[model samples]
Each structure stands twice: as structure tokens, then as C-alpha cells.
Target: MRPAFVAALALCLAALPAQAQQRFKSSAGDLVVETVAEGLQNPWGLAFLPDGRMLVTERAGRLRLVSSDGKLSAAIANTPNVTGRGQGGLLDVALDPDFAGNRLIYLSFAEPRAGGNGTSVARGKLNQADTALEQVAVIFRQMPTINSNMHFGSRLVFDRTGALFVTTGDRYGQRDEAQNPANHIGKVIRIRPDGSVPADNPNKPGWQPEIWSIGHRNVQGAALHPQSGQLWTAEHGARGGDEINTPKAGLNYGWPVITYGVDYSGLKIGEGTAKAGMEQPLFYWDPSIAPSGAAFYTGERWPGWKNSLFVGGLAGQMLVRLSTQGEAVTGEERLLDGLGERIRDVRQGPDGYLYLLSDDAKGRVLRVRPAP
Candidate 1:
């Protein structure tokens, strides 16, 4: 074929969107990228309702439902108050395992408290009308809230046993706090749906009972492994060193003490890349991609991607697919860089489709389907 012909073909393929010309090529196979919804302001999180509609959170502190047909609902009434500062606002949302019966849902947000602001998790019931959250109460609060507006590392995940796992940041300015499990900053906390600590938790003397693991930086993305039932997280590093970690209870995942990246100022960070007792990451990315949301694909829509882990990127503005073999990341592939949007979250729909939320002033919810 002539070069001009090949160039024209590429341009035509690049025009794919929600309707005509929706097919795009990927290593796995051909994929049809469809715009399920658009015009969301910095959509930060997404959760599917039992009936098939989606609950989406805008970073500016509003919660809306996006119908499958592409209609976006008005902001749901009575969402908990949030602090919409730098990286702070309404964040991740998750439905209760028994949501069909209890109508309970969990939300993680940057909470404005007396000291300043910090990440907090709350639970509320979606009323029958679907217009409001009723019986809302904060289930967990980051202790001794700092004055900084950054690093409210948060993502809500529910394990197989009804336990709620909350991930937190080091509150930016206080990186040292990540090493100390006594405080909530930079920790993965495990708690009951009602905000009570589990009796079987690490509960180390002098340490907070809710802490499941420690020494994490700004871990914005997390998901439970479909087959292993283990919790995996994607975390942000300074200049480099984005990491994927499968957190185990009471383990310390060296942050400042043993980072693969350096400080933003080009200065060395931590003691080094290794330590005696700290846990090493399963994988790390140099020139950090600023990862945010994570999901494990167990669906059949993309057979080539089955059992793979998908993570969304903010700084890198793409979707990353990591081939996995039982908790091990074997290889990595970056997708959607041409979309030119910051992927804030990734999800797998019940019907075996992959969904994404693009973060921007005019964000979009996109669906990826098998193309003919």
C-alpha cells in the first residue's frame, strides 16, 4: 500500500467515538470505544447500581447518577460535606455487598474538620426515590487532621468477608507519619461497615487498631483480587517509583525509607531502595504515571485480557493493562494515550464491558467493547 493510503487509514481509525467509527485497535484485539456519558466535571469515582445505572462523583463535591442510555442525573441530595481543595474532594464510592437489600453505600472524601482537612469514609442509604442519601453517618475519620490540602490517599474497597478497606495518604507534608502506624495517615485501614475495628486485626500494642498495613504514600487506586481475595493497590511516588502492591495485614511497605524514586527536587529520598524488614513492591514504574483507580478483569468480553489487572492514570493520562498470573504482574501495556484524557478510574461492568472515567473540566465516561 502507498504511504498516503496508510496515513489516511490511520486518520480514519482515529476518528472513532461513541457512534460511527467506534472501533480502535489494541494489542489484545480490536476494541470499540463508546462515550457512555460526557460533560462531567472531573469525574473522580464510579460505582454501578444494582439496577444497572451508575453513581459517579465529581471532584467538586457533587454526586450524580449516569444512566446506561447516557442521561446524567441531577446531583444526589444529602451527600456528606466535602473539602474541595487540592486533590481533596469527594473521592471513591462503593456499594455494600448487600446493597440490594440494605441500600447502603460507602463514600470516601476529603473531610473538613477542626484542624483542617483529612480523608474520611461515610456510609449512607440510597432512598427508594434515588434522589437522596438518607441515614448518612461518617464511618471513619483520619485522626488529627492536618492543615495540608494534599495526599488524602483514599479508595474504598470491600473484601469477600464484608470488611471495608480504606487507603490513605501521608498528608503530603508529613511523610514521616507514614512510618508510624499510630496515626491514620499513609495507612490501609480495615474496619467493619459500622466503623468498628475488627477484633482479629493486627492490633499491635501502641498502634491504632484499625491499621491493616502501613508505610504507603498517596495510594489512589485499589481493588480486590477476584480469585485470590487479596487487596492490591496502585500508589503515587514523587518523581518516579509508581508502585503496585498487594497489601497483607500488619506489613510495612517502605515508603520514604526505601523508595525507588527520588524527591521532586532531584534529591535522594529515603534510606535507599531496600530495607531489612519492609516489604518490597511487586512492581514499580519509573517517571511515575500518577496512578489513581484500579480493577481486576475477570470477565469474558476480552478473553485476551481475562485475569489481567487494569489501572487508570492521571499524570500519564492513559489506561495500563498488567498481565497477571495469580497476584504476579508479568507484563505491562499502556493504552488510550491517544485519547488524551486523564483516566481517573477503571471498572468492569456486569455485562463484561470495561468502563473508564476521564478526569477533566469536561470529563467523560467511556466504555470499551469487543469490536467486530
Candidate 2:
């Protein structure tokens, strides 16, 4: 997902429950949460198979498949080794637009390099015989990889045009790289499914040329709005400035240069929150929700939530629902606060239920629906 904007880990006092503890009220009132699967460790991302099964990724670099009957399969072993320190590990997973016919999938992970780790995306065909992946090959890689252990910003989403989008972190010390088109850090890159640059992108003289927009800090959550066919992303702010942005082609998002968040030590970031050349966030959270995963609701089970945006919060330990009217965030609601666990990802399943993954050693996948 977006670069991690999380607080340092504190001593594990009392373990939080793996499931939500109370009935949450939305506009419809009284939300019900049920356990779909359990006994997962740091479940990171999830994508639904065409047959209504789910493919899930774990940060420790294991991939697992869940059948429609909620049976968890053995870990798929072909996943490459990951430098699973801090935020570096296996991250987001996605299915090809034509996965039903193609049986292809994509994954993002922290790749170990000479100096340190960099993010990489690979594609493969899942062979159902042994439930393992085959013909896996890296399609994209970040350049000039750094030595830091944080801010990988590895999330994947496909647009309506069949192009793929990938997010990169600024490597903690290189926040300014987000503003430099010549660098891949802190940027959302657009590419063809086979990892080639699209010729129509805003070309820079000596830049990587795949960058769609620059000046992003760390983006973990991305989804395509069903109605407008537009892209939306959520990222962690420094301390208090988490943001939700509507990304546009050739635009600047103004990360370190303009931010609503102060440093963790309570110091100012840039000159101010606004800059002449930058696009504004659709909505920003002042106290920082530590946004991790997001999905636009298009499930038939919740018809009233058809156009809403669902986001998972790590630090805030909640699910956020935003009512959107043509990119304007008109209303906000919180769900599953009583869960007491850090939410890592949110996805709408093929069966029309909303699924969530918790970010803990004993993390579990949960389903939410209207109470019977």
C-alpha cells in the first residue's frame, strides 16, 4: 500500500481481539462482522478469483488461496524471499483484468539488492494442480534503490484502460525525490500490463518517462471509482496529515514541499500546505488515520454503499467510509472501531461481501454485512 506512516511499535501489552467486538452503526445502522478466515500472520493484500475464491498475501512472503467455502489452502511456495523488516516484505496482490480467462496474477514485494531492498512487481500464472504459481517473472523494478528499511509504497491497481499503476516510496531520507521527475521515488508510475511505458504519458527530457504523477509521500491504498472510471489513492501523512487524492495525468501532488502534517517531533514540514503548481487532496485527515488499504464499493450486497469509498486504518484501528459525489468527499463515517485491531487492507469479494485483513501476528480475514 502507500508508504507506511505508522507510529513506532510499543510493547505488546494486552493483545487486541482478532474480530470486531461491537455492532457498529452506519447510515443504515448496526453493522455485523463475521470471521471468514483466521490464523493468518500479517495478511497484507487480497484479490478475488473469478470463481469467487480469494488469493491472499502475507508480509512474510507466503501466498495462500481461500476457497469459496472458506477453506484456507497450503501456502504457495514459489513466492520469492522478502526482506521482511519494518515495512519491507511481500505487499499488494492483484489479478489480471482477464484473470478468469488468463489465470494470471501480479504481486509487489521488497526485493533484496546490493545496498538494500527495493520494490519489485512480478507476474505469473497460477497452476491449480498444486495451487502454486508458475512462470513468474519480475515485470518492473525501482531504480537507484536505497538502504533504508521504510517507505516502500508498493500497491497495485488497474485502470479502466487496462494500464497498471504502481506506487513508490521516497525511501525516508529522500522525500525530495518525490518532486523530481527524474527519480522514481514518491511517484505513481503508469505502465502497460507487460511493463512497457505508454507513449501518451507526459514525457520529461531525461526522466524515467513512466511516471504519471509525482510528489507523493507513500501511497498504500488505490482503487478505481466505478462510476467515473477515475483513480483514487490514500496515503499516510507525516504525523497528522494523511490524505486521499484523486490522481490525474501529469499532475503534481506536493509531498514534502507542501503538507498538512508536521514531523513526528512536532516540527513543520514544508513552507505551507498549498503550492501553486500542486493539486489539492480531496480529503485530508488531520490526526492521521494511517490509511493502508482502500476499495470503492460496488458490491450488490450493500446496494446503498455502491458509490462509497472504504478505507482501512492502521493507527486509528477502524474502517472509514466516505460518501463521494464526483470526487468531492461529502460525508464520513467510521466502522468497526470496536475491532481494536489495526486494519491492513479492504476488498470487496466476488460474493458481494466486504473482506478485511488485520495487521498483526495473528491477523485474520473478516467479513462485514448487514445484521440478519
User: TM-score: which candidate is best?
Assistant: 1
Q: Per-residue lDDT for 1-372 in model 2, tens only?
A: 112211111111011122443467778767777766777889999987654567889998889987645668999868877888889889999989998678889999988989887888988888867378898988888877888889998789998888999988888888988888887899998988899998877777666788899999999999999999888999889998899998888899999999999999999998799989998899999999999999999866678788899999999999999999987998898888778889999998655567899899987888877776
Q: Which whole-number lDDT from 0 to 100 does residue 203 have in model 1?
A: 92
lDDT agreement with native, every candidate = 0.88, 0.84
Best lDDT goes to which candidate?
Answer: 1
Lowest-lDDT window of 10 residues in candidate 1? 12-21
Give candidate 1's whole-model lDDT.
0.88
- Tens digit per residue, CA lDDT, model 1, 1-372: 365754554343233346422566689787777788888989999998865678999999999998656788999999989999888999999999999899999999999988799899999999999999999999999987899889998999999889999999999899988999889989999999999998888998768999999999999999988888999999999999999999998899998899999999999998999999899999999989999999999877777888788999898988899998887899999886577778999999766778899899898888887777
**Candidate 1 pairs with clashing backbones:** 153-169
TM-score of candidate 2 against the unseen true structure: 0.93
The Cα RMSD in angstroms, rounded to one decimal, for candidate 2 relative to the true structure is: 7.7
Model 2 misplacement above 4 A = 1-22
Give Cα distance to truth, residue 319, candidate 1, Å.
0.6
